[model samples]
Target: MCRLFAITSKDPLSPMVAIEALDVMREGHDGSGVGLFLRDLGGPFDDMKDAPILSGIFTEKGIRRLDGFMMEIGFMTKYKLSIKIPKTPPPGVPKRDIYLIRAYEYPEEWEDLTSDEKYSRLMNMRLELRKMGEEKKDMIVFSFWPDVIMIKEIGDPLSVARHLGLDRKDLMARVVMAQGRQNTNYAINLYACHPFFLEGFSTMTNGENTAFIPIKEYLISRDFHGYTGYQSDSEIFTHILHYTLTKLGLDIQTYKHIITPLQDKSIEAHPNGNFLKHLKHSCRRLIIDGPNCVIGSLPDHSLFMVQDRKKLRPGVVGGRPGMFAFSSEVCGLDAVIPDRDKSKDFQPMHLDTAIVGPDRQEVSICRQTEPLPLLR
Candidate 1:
C-alpha cells in the first residue's frame, strides 16, 4: 500500500511538514515515488493569486519549445521560480535538467473572456503542452492553475523533499497533499505518482482500485480532454470527483453514494432511496471495488477524506481550531500536530466523509445518508 498525507491550515504551511510525517510511515510504502500538490499557495504565489502558474520539469530543448509555444499563444511570463535541486542528490535518483514553476500573463483577448473561458483556455494550453512533451519526452507538466503547484519525483519521500529543497519556508500553501507511492500494478512511471490533478480537483489514494478498467473507460468516454490518462488507478478517483461535482452538477457529498452506493436493501430504507438506486444503476461503472482511502481537495479549498466501503485501508483525521489533517495512520498525524486533542481524532469508517471547509475553522463529518431524490 502507498501512504497518503494531507493538511489544510488557516495559514500557508510548508509541505515539508507533511513530508516529514510521511517518512514516519515509510514502512507502508516502498518509496517508488513522492507526489506533492499544494493549493492556496503562499510565498511568491501569494501575491499572484490570479495569474495562472505552470509547474513542470523541462529539458533545455523542451524549455525553448515551451517558451516559443506560449509566445505564439499570447501568454507572457510574468514570474518564474525553479526548484533548487541539491548539489548532490541521493544515489540512483536521476538528475533533473530543469524544474520550473512559472506564472504567465493571459493573452489580451482573454481579458474579455469569462472565468470559465479562461479556465478552459488554460486547460487546453496545458493539454497541448503535455501532448507535445509526450512526443518529445523532454517536458513533464504537472499542473497549470492560479493557486496550485504540483511536484513529483522518484524516490523516498524524505529524500525527494531534500533533493527538491522543499524545507525552505517560502514553499508553502494552506493545503498540501503528499503521497509516498508504492507501485503495485504499473511500471514505475512518474506520472503514475499520487495526488493527481484535473482542473481544480486533486486526489491521492492509498490502496488499489479493482474496478479501474471500467472506471477508466467510463471517464475517457466523456468529451472532456483531461480524462485521457490512467497512469495509476488512483487517478480515476480524481476524475470521479470532477465528474460527480463539475460534470454532473451534484453536491460533493453525493460522491460517496456514487462511488460506493449502499446495498439495494439498505438504499431502499432512505428517503432518497429511489433516486440513489437510479444513480447507482446509471453510474455503476464509477463504483470503486477495492479497499482504498482517498484524500482530496476542491476548488474552494475544502479538504475531504473517505474510505472504501470495506474500510480496507487505515485513515485518521485530526485537527485543531485552525488546521485539519488526514493520514493513513495516526503516526503520520502525530508527527505534524502532536499537541492537538487526540480524543477528537476521527477514524472514518465505511461510508463516511470527513470534510474541512475553506475557512479551516471546523471539521464536518458527513456520514452515509439515505439516498434522497434530487429536489427540484
Candidate 2:
C-alpha cells in the first residue's frame, strides 16, 4: 500500500512539511514515486490566482512546441517559476530540460468567458500538450488549472523533492497533498501519479480501485476529455469526484454515496432513502470496491478524507485551528502537527467522509449511517 499525506493551512507552508510527514510513515510505501498537488498557493504564485498555471516537465523540443502553441492560441505568459536543475541528480531521478510551473493570461477572446468555459479550454489545451509529448516523448503535463500546481516523479519522496528543487521557499502553498507511492498494481508511469487534477479539483489515493474499468468506461463515455488517462486504477477516484460535483451538479456528501454507496437495507434506513437509491441506480458504474483511502481537495480548497466501504486502509486527520492534516498514519500526522489535540484526531471508518473546509478549522465527520443534515 502507498502512504498518503495532505495538509491545509491558514498560511503558506513548505511542501517539506508534508514530505517529511510522509517520511515518518515510510514503511508503508515502497519509494517507487512521489506526487504532490499544491493549491491555494503562496510565495510567487499567490498573486496569480486568476491565471491558469501550466505545470509539467518538458524537453527542449517539447517546450519549443509549447511556446509556439501558446503564442498561436494567444495565451500570454503572466508569470513563471523557474527551477535550476542540479547537474548531478540523486540516483534514480531522470535528467530533464525544464521543470516548469507557468501562469498564463487567457486568450483575449476568452476574457468574457465563464469559469466553466475557461476550464474546458484549459483541459483541452493540456490534453493536446500531453498527446504531443506522448507522440515524441517530450512533455508530461500534470495540471493546467489556476492556483494549483502538481509535481510528480519516480523516486524516494525526499530525493525527488531535492531533485526538483521543491524545497525552495518560493514553492509554498496554503494547501498541499503528497503521496509516497508504492507500485502496487502497475509499473511506474509519471502520468499515473497521484493527486490527479481537473477543473480545480484534485485527489490522491492509497490502495486500489477494483472497479476501475467500469468506472473508466462510464467516465470516458461522457463528453469530457479530461477523463481519458487510465494509467493508474486509483486515478478514477478523482474523475468520479469531478463528475459528481461538476457534471452531475451534486453536493459533496453525494460524492461519498456515488463512489461507495450504502447497501439496500442501509439506503432504506437513510433519511434520504429515495434520493440515495436513485443515486446508486444511476451511478452504479462509479462504485469503488477495493480497500482505499482517498484524500482530496475541492475547488474551494477544502480538504477531505474518505475510507473505503471495507475500511481496510489506515488514515487519520488532525490539526488545531487554522491548520489540519490528513495522513495515512498518526505518526505521519504527528510529524506535522505534533501539538494538535490527539483526542480530536479522527480516523475515518467504513462509510465516513471527514472534511476540513477551506477555513482550516476542525474536521466535521459525516458518516453514511448518520450523514449531515445538509443532504439534498
Q: Which parts of model 1 are misplaced by more than 4 Å?
A: 370-376
Runs of candidate 2 exceeding 4 Å displacement: 371-376
Q: Give the lDDT of residue 152 in candidate 1.
A: 88
lDDT of 1 by residue, 85-128 (tens): 76567865678888888999989989999998888888888888
True lDDT of residue 343, candidate 2 = 96
Each prediction's Cα lDDT score?
0.88, 0.88
Q: How does model 1 score by TM-score? A: 0.97
The Cα RMSD in angstroms, rounded to one decimal, for candidate 1 relative to the true structure is: 1.5
Predicted structure 2, TM vs. truth: 0.97
Instruction: Report the Cα lDDT for residue 173, model 2.
Output: 95
1-376, model 2: which lDDT tens digit per residue?
8899999999999998989888889998888889999999999888888889999999989899999989999999998989988888788787788998999988989989998788898899889999988999999999898998999888899988877777898899999999997446777789888878878788898888878888899998997788888898988888899998888888677799999899899999888998889989999999998788999999999999998877888999999999999999999988889998899998998778899998887798888877546664
